[model samples]
Target: MKRLKEDNLKHFFAEETLKKYSVVFIIILAVMLICELFIFNFKWVNSAFDKKVDAEMTLSGINESGTDLKFTSDSATIEYKNLNEELKYLYFKPGSNKGGVADITLSAVDEANSSYFSAPSRTVLTDVKSSEYIRLRFSGEVKDFKITVNGMNGKTISKDNIGLNVRVPLMFSWIRFLLLSLTLMLLYVLRPKSFVYNYKTDLSKNWQRIVTLALVAIQIITFWNMIHWNTGVLEWHKSYEHHRQYYSLIDAIKEAHLYLDFEPSSALKNMDNPYDFRERYAQNVAFKWDHAYYDGKYYVYFGAAPAILLYLPYNLITGNDLPNYIAVFIFGIMIMIGILLLLWEIIKKWFRNTPFALYLLLSVVFGAAACLAYAVQKPDFYLVPSLGAIMFGLFGLAFWLSAERKNEDGTTSLISWRLAVGSACVAIIAGCRPQLLIVTVFGIILFWNSVFKERTLFSKKSLKQTVAVCLPFVIVGAAVMWYNYARFGSPFDFGANYNLTTNDMTKRGFVWGRTGLGIFTYLLQPFNMDAVFPFIHDFNAATVYQGLTLTEMLMGGVLWLYPILVIGLYGAFKKNSFSDRRSYRFVYFSVIFAVILAILDAQMAGLLTRYFTDFVWIAFIGTIITAFAYYEMLRDNEHSRRKFAGIILTFSVITLVLCFLSIFAHTEDSIMKANPTLYFTVQHLIAFWM
Candidate 1:
């Protein structure tokens, strides 16, 4: 009986082992399939497919009087239909010249049988001279004639140019699908068992609940602020009319629509300058209160779908005057919330025993500076989407890192669900900005590595579950793509209007060139840029100057956690254990990705540190790792740990003092030049700091 019990136990253990490692096999297979299909283009079959549609139009005329007729060909075509009256009208492309004339020869057999207008030929005066439409007149007598219209041949309109590349060989697409499926399957089969065990931990459960509530509150607050503050207050409204000095909100909306919808034509004269089109579209639009909602084209629009949806109800309730300040406020609040959540997740996962109070204070000050700087200066809410995405990624990393390990048993272990929620947030981030798709891909890879490479969680079922977790992001991403296609004709196209208002093409070069310069200037200017309190406004012959200090850049003050973050990176590189290294690798990848993005988007005027805020979060992660390293080092020496802690505190205080001093210097200068009262208040603050 004892021998039989041992055999049963062994069988149970074997089954459990299979379940644990199945996801790893699944992922490996999936990866192999992907590599073979898309990258190698392994072909299984060859076939040809073709599809075509033909359209025809016919026009007939029956008249008794012999009439001199004219036929004009406008770029725009109209579908033909039969009319019973002698007089008929058909819409055609607007003519090129103001009063262009076309002469049509009308021939018909005596007033008896059907008068044939067989393909009436006329020299249609083209409107190649002006941007404005030219009306063409065509006069004809009643006669029987048939006009056959052929296929259209003209410049394609923006709407008609939808380039859906469905023509990629079906075999290739099938192979890709197959490979993706297989890789996903393998990933599932070979995934680590620890993931499930860690997920079962109470730490994971509690944090998940806490983070969810925080996220919900943040989302609600963001929505409220976007609708109530930005959209409600800063929106342009009509208060004056006779003097034509004040612009109407309706005009602003119209201008936005025109700017978004306008298409340039080769045949239109005096339309050579694209800026003219933009300028004409923006004319008569005025600022509301002290803030202008429109960027001469679109309203200072926040492009995230959730935010937009939230604002819709409010817009309906209040009518269309959406204040820009609402967006600004929401953006600010969201940034703060994201940063707090990130810091909280990091501390909870890695530094739970550390002083939460100190961490909170440091997080608030640092996050506020970074977020507020971006908000007040740039005022572009479109960036919120990207920011939201990075926040989600951070959440995912936190969860993956915080999962608990399980010993040899059939029971489950626990992992941080706060981290899972964070991963889920990546989808929301991607929705806000499509470019973050790169980050999303990197995130998926990191997650896969965590589950398979580190924890050895593998099974078909686990792989499917992983894909399911990722589905929301994919669906949202596809929706964004479709939206882009609908608006821009191509999913990848950002539309033709790539102009920046302040930075002219000559000074900044083309957009890409300017962005390159911006990146270069950002890293280089820290050494030389002047500092001013409240405001740092100086413009060189070409560049705008803002004051930033070197010490702040190096030590990061309340942001001192950045230096510590490097320690985490060091752990990632040196530690052989999956748990110790995976999070660091993920953060490292994120930082690199963020840097690349910044470089790609270098067209902005300055290389503001705010642009790299996501990277700063990665630095925070590094700091956590560094703190862990410090803890480990002090494990045998209590006195040293105490000394190290004191040193860190001192360093933080000194950094803060220096930052304040820098701010004070700038405030004093500004007050001397502009406002004495404000200057005195700043001076008093400086004195207090001193």
Candidate 2:
């Protein structure tokens, strides 16, 4: 019986399977070796252990009170006059700075040679609130050196928590290495093959559900991981203290009012031109921040759809205000589902012959793109409308594409319910994000053959279809307009012009010169790279236009961040490559609409990364469409098909990594600010040898 069992186990574990596993193990080992030697700069495995070295040092030009080194002036010095041997590292455990460091510098000098030694240009305690250990390394040998601090800005360093020649272990991140190995194995298995290219099998039909479930789980996990550190309890109208607009809007609606309950200060109301930021600051007047101030009333200038759809219902049922992070989580999952449904519909309708691997690649590209990450990372009231618009817009397009039905006699007819539902979803965008309502224009092109070419939209033969397509728009539009009128006294005025913000929007008309800067910054900005962990950094957007151009530090432009989207431009001109003419038109129109929205956002809102939400999705869709068509075109050439598929996967993986790390850049809204411990831990884990 034992011999028989062993034989059966051997049969199950074939030699080929063993060989594959061995290859994967060997690949992982090779990668770790390279990282330890070249990337982490570890000399030997035995050197991983730390060794303490003794040195005599003296401090000057600084006052030591308790553990703090308070600089008497703008500069201070620490001279290591004697050392047993050459020193390699100096470790520091920083003291707390709630207000954060400002223009601080620490320079190492071999004072005898009058030369500056290498060190971090700025301190590694970037997250000033934490007391984590940080180290400074020397390039060659350092028997004697003086460390100088300039531009101190009244900052203090911890005096007692310092060490010399602390030889810490040189370790590579095992978690990251294992993840890379798994990712490589997954890609190798999912790579294009003969079976994948066989369109008759329709492998996407089998894999779509599985891939979507995995993506949804990933989205939820990331959302929770970001918030788990801070979320302690739920409270009624909890976000009110944080000046959340949605919470306040729901509270007002519950009390049967159209405007927010926040009252404008009499001083600001009495002043002429309260919209002027300088006037508000100069007078020291207290007023609601970012609220619409019109005729002595404060109103929520942001869309009310999120409040009515999510916050109001939650408040009514549970008597507790829904937090923005929870709402964002729900919307993000819906967006992922909508992306899958839309991609499935498009593949089913037009690109039926698309390779299975290509479909999976597009799923990652569309579902987890940089724009969605930006919108979801800092969950707040500001992100609610953008997420809502994206979620519903994707569903609207998907339902619209799915409305066509094949009949018994080889003819097609529109499903009345599906058409009406799709229109209703599209109309909701006007309430959530007015700028994104431009997506509804695609409906006209989608039904052009039936409405204009065949004149069947209003014909007696298709009366139900006409009502299904038109009634929802009329009803939703009227409701949205009525809501607007109730708030701002006029249906046409959405109340943005009356906002008490940085500029007087009512008088800030368009400037022709701003267009050039807007386009360049939004579409053509390049990324700043460095030889450090999370190397992508933010850059100043310099423009020749002499105007008050409002721009924050930009990480990079959308096109440069995701270079794969450039294919959409080629797809626009290569109309003959597409199998479906209507699909070709959709791609062409998407490119134009993306450009128009970019110009609109740049002109109206100025340059910010969050504005990418307005148009990146549509551009990604166009690019994905082009990619599918290109893949199908290469069906006859197997080698070309495999090569193209590999290129798509490579671009997608690299782009996803860059986008996720972009959140950690030195920006105002960075992970380092929100959670300092997590940031430094990751920094140390990846660059342990540093």
**TM agreement with the true structure for every prediction:** 0.48, 0.86
Q: Which stretches of candidate 1 lie over 4 Å from their true place?
A: 1-270, 273-302, 306-310, 320-322, 347-353, 373-424, 435-442, 450-459, 500-520, 527-579, 603-614, 632-635, 654-680, 687-690
lDDT of 2 by residue, 1-690 (tens): 999999876764443365655665687668866875556544334234657665655777777777677766666676775442445555554445543343323445443334555455444453532222335454445556666656553667776545665544444556656766677666665555423445432534556556557766886687566543322222212534434778778878878887878777899889989999888999999988788888888888887888899988998999986877788778877887788778777777787777655676676667566355664446656777888998889999999989977579866678888899898888888878889988887888778777765555668889999999889889988988998898778987888888888888888678878887777787778888887766888877887767666678887777887777787777999999998888888789888888888888878878877777888888888888888888778878979988887777777877777766775674565666565556655665555544
> For candidate 1, what is the lDDT?
0.39
- Show model 2 residue runs off by greater than 4 Å: 1-22, 29-52, 60-78, 93-112, 115-118, 121-141, 147-161, 170-172, 190-208, 226-243, 408-410, 454-456, 687-689
Top candidate by TM-score: 2
Return the clash pairs for model 2, or none.
none
Which 10-residue window in model 2 sums to the lowest lDDT?
Answer: 228-237
